[model samples]
Target chain A: MIERRIQSGVGPKTGHKNEKGVGCLNIIVCIKQVPSTSNVEVDPVTGVLRRDGIKSKMNPYDLFALEQAFLLREQYGGTVAALSMGPNQAMDVLYEALYMGADSAVLASDRRFAGADVLATSYTLAQCVRKMGKYDLIVCGKQTTDGDTGQVGPEMAEWLEIPHACNAISIESFSEGAFTVKVNMDHSIYTLKIEAPCLITVDKDVNTPRLPSYLRRKRAGNAQISVWSMDDLADQAESHYGLSGSPTQVERIFPPEAHDDRECFKGSGEELADRLYSLLRQKKRI
Target chain B: MAHIEVNQKKVTPEIAERLSSVCPFGALVVGEKGLSIESGCRLCGLCLKADKDGVLTLVKDEPTVEVVKSSSRGIAVLAECMGNQVHPITLELLGKALEMAAPTGQPVFVVVIGWKVSSAVESLRCYGADKIYVYDDRSLEHFEPLRYASCVEDFVRKVRPSVVMAGATSMGRSVAPRIAARFRTGITADCTGLALREDGDLVQTRPAFGGNIMAQIVTPRTRPQLCTVRYRVFDAAQKREGPTSQVEVMEEPDGLEKAGACILEVLAKPKEPDISEAEVIVAVGRGVKDEAGLHLVRKLADILGAQLACTRPMVENGWFDPRRQIGLSGRTVKPKLIITIGVSGAVQFAAGMDKSEFIISINNDPEASIFNISHLGLVGDLYEVLPAFIEKVGREEPVR
Candidate 1:
């Protein structure tokens, strides 16, 4: 309980003089560097993702989340810090975030944190959040292309003890202490007004993400990304750090089977329908 | 045989009251007789976190316990139901679970948790469930993610099954992850294929990177392997006379009323037949430029007596109901015949309709990806091709 209340209004701001100086919000955008190609290899012996020597990119979904953060920062006058957890190479995504106008960036990496699942990953990220000072909001992609769980944001919110909404389609409005967000909840869309210090997992296509500005890239070329290890986190529990902290174990990984059984028929509209009807009738599926 | 016990000598009323607050399920009760452990206890160990003086202990039935591999005795299927009828995907999952259990000496169990689901019990037995665990309670009258997950987690821990399968529907998508998070287990979502490895492990396959590739995943070390198979990926389990089934009703977990995110109100969509059930479906995409284009698409659907569906663009354009949209964010359909008009098949849209028995796609651009999965591809302007098809069908003028 070492004063986790986030310090307000303290970061490299876009020195605009016309901004309101009362209380600026701090937003943390959670991002990850995933295999640029979906053809990722799994370690046969260890049942883990093999990350060595593969081209990586910022998760496609995270671009939406980052873009949303930048839009909010431009509108409400806040600092956006991009955070990620992976190998030391994960800093590449953080640097991309910086070029895309993140005020600052940080990467939490450790050998002990390897092979972590959704729960362990969320817990580790929560620990990093605690150590990285306070923020008014945390945003993440709806799900990772690699893990695709869509549980980390809410789970991390549970660990941090905050409210969160998933599948967010839009940020309708924001005021002093709360935000009105529209979320697609499967069957229907819901408009929820969540208080500050909340988390949201943004859906895809919320907005067009701006390209990394060459001017910002040149100016921020010397910007440093702070790296945090397990020791830096408030919770230094060994069991809660890496593979041991993970409840689910990867027993095995393999490629999926595919069926190439197909018959192509060329015909006119009526002929195709008649042929389809006869085929279905033969199979007794009509 | 792991069970929670309260030490009578060390327990006090104050401690008992605190213990009652600790278990979210309200398993530990403080009564005139000091304290009692109820059947509703889920063994979540939240009480252990609260009891500082060690008044309660979880006693294992045996010592020197070797590492516990995944359960090898039973396969479990989570029954997803709505409007008192079990979703067909539940039966499909049960069918696959039964197949997975066939080679191994394991029984299939179905857990149906809802009110007034007695009729579903017979259907579960017909679908090959040896035992149907029913938790029919007032608290479960409506679906709440936390409450439903707590109930399932309690049952899962009690009878550690080898594999747990659920339909990759809205409810499944929401609750499965919560259960996995609670048990600290791995779960694969939207799996298109599932198979058993040589050593009784499950190999779950799903599309990744926007359907660029299909990846196979496994839980490997987790007990009660969990996965959510997309709808229509497998055929529905055929009904058969199985062994005389037993319906065991478990006590409802208490404190479910306090679960977060109460459904204030569920605004129903406009009444329309679920497109997945349609035998023939004709869908339109962005290629259908205007209302005139939509009219022809409707005309063709009417000629075939088929249901009308669309890709995300149609719904986004306000030309079709969201319910009629087919894609990853929309409903999944596996119709006998599905024809796409002017629809360039994005992976998201293809995921919902790829399992159709036959696919015929019409796109003016020959390079459109929709041709990749189609059984019949027509490269022509829809405006020109639609009228010819309508005339050849010899259908009466469609009444608007």
Candidate 2:
């Protein structure tokens, strides 16, 4: 749990400001490993994705969150910790984060954490954050490519009983233990000031993520990564860890029917263009 | 505990092999117990369909939450306010909620949370809501997820509605989960379809894995089952002849002033119309290789007076704003005419614009999947085709 150390002279109406001072921000970035390719196929007869040797990589969206964390750390002297919750292989993303300049890495891996939906997954990560001790801010990608649900970050904030902002495009500045963030809300953009000890999920294209530095990788060789299981968490109840903790369940899964009824036209470009023009006019779609 | 029960007598070597192969997560194995379920099983229910001889069954322990089951009633729609007016998606959700409530005779409630939202609440009156709950205050002018969620939570706690829904907009996506988390209930995001069972359970159907498959989700054990649907998935509620809903002014919830985030300023995007509202769209994809290729497509769009859109890759490639992206993660558009150039029509992209009245696809590859969903498929290179199309459209009379 984070300590909300209210500093003197900062009025209560202005929101809580940590006593850690301005330049010593402690940030935790949550990352995930997703299937490298989006073109995963499902077997026709069995109705299951063919998962026989699919490679995995850090989620493309997470790179934005990591880059945001790095930018904050660069501007304000602070430590950026990269955290992930997945199988043992998920450490690859943590190492990738380390190579990209994260000060430390942690992984929450347990067999009991399998089959976790968004609720359970966020609960588990929140528990891990609690066990990790004090921190000012938590960062996450807008959503995962596989799940496509942008709820985990806010849900985690709920479990931590902290405030959260989503779809953040940029962190404009930090002062008095609060950060001003610009969020892209599709039709409009909001510039908001969120106090420290909160969570923010960054949208994609926030910044150009830096490539893993070879020198940094060499310097951080064999850097220890803390791995935590369910036993290591403050919440030890089995019911709140994985499948049991998840309130929503996948009742059924089926392939989307492909529409195949189409009129194919084969001709020269000019002919096709003329054909399309006339068809559009005839169909009143021009 | 929920577990898969495999009937050993019905399991043969061939059956075991088939079940094991059908298990996407490799949670099935042919072992000394004949056929066993492992920990990796996600309860996706694919193996049950694969088992021809009834060899598998999913055993779920009944939830013991009778109190919640008995208390929850009606369906509530969180009518999101855009600026001072109600968002169109809120009307769409009201339409859906009213439809779901008709058969069960359950009342449909609308919650409007915003400052100076009387006009918005007044406009919602003719939408057939049984009651419109308004949480109007000066501090609620800008959307703070926690404050907005607190207002909605107060209504939910008091009414104990069986289901609560909101639009899948940025505000909805941010606030719905927080509300759901507060109640410790399930929340499904970007649901494409919603249905209510006789037992009052909300069935939320949504696409997953980049629109590769559709999954049906249910929150049987939780009250006020939460879900969000994207815009344009359902029709907006038509206003009735006269106002019918009873308006209840709600007091601002406690701690309203202590929101975690403060909106310093709101910058409304320049009036470039959203693609979801576009009548005609000219969409390009990965096949439009370079900026030169994009230039040709842009010319075509200009000639047609159509909005220019693109697939996810084109946006990721920095060729277009993310708002112009049409896919599962982006906007869902049902334009009157959508001309897809060099697009292979990945399911994720198709899921967005498939409902368009007319689809014309131009791709060099004859086997491109874009043709499958297109009304007219041209088997030619975009480089050769776009120029001719542009020339013809420019010379012709304005269609719009």
Give the per-residue Cα lDDT of candidate 2 at A66.
93
TM-score of each prediction: 0.67, 0.89
Best by lDDT: 2
Task: List the DockQ of the predictions in order.
Answer: 0.07, 0.45
**Tens-digit per-residue lDDT, A7-122, candidate 2:** 11111332234575477678899999886765655655667665554568999899999999999988987889999988777889999999999999999887677667887888
Question: What pairs collide in candidate 1?
Answer: A6-A134, A251-B219, A251-B220
Model 2: DockQ against the native?
A: 0.45
TM-score for chain B in model 1: 0.76
lDDT of 2 by residue, B118-220 (tens): 8888889999999998899988888888888888888887888999999888989998988877777899998878999878889998877553667788987
For residues B1-400, what per-residue lDDT tens digits would candidate 1 score against the true structure? Answer: 3457788788888898777765533447888777777644434455765688889896633322233664444778899766477888888988888788788767788999888888777667677677889888766766655567768877887887777888776567656766665555667777777887766577877665343334556666566777887778788878886646677888777656554333433454454678988998999999999889989988878767789999977886788877798976677899988889889876567767888988878787776767778877777677767776666445434432
Q: What is the TM-score of chain A in candidate 2?
A: 0.87
Model 1 CAPRI rating: incorrect
Interface root-mean-square deviation, candidate 1: 13.8
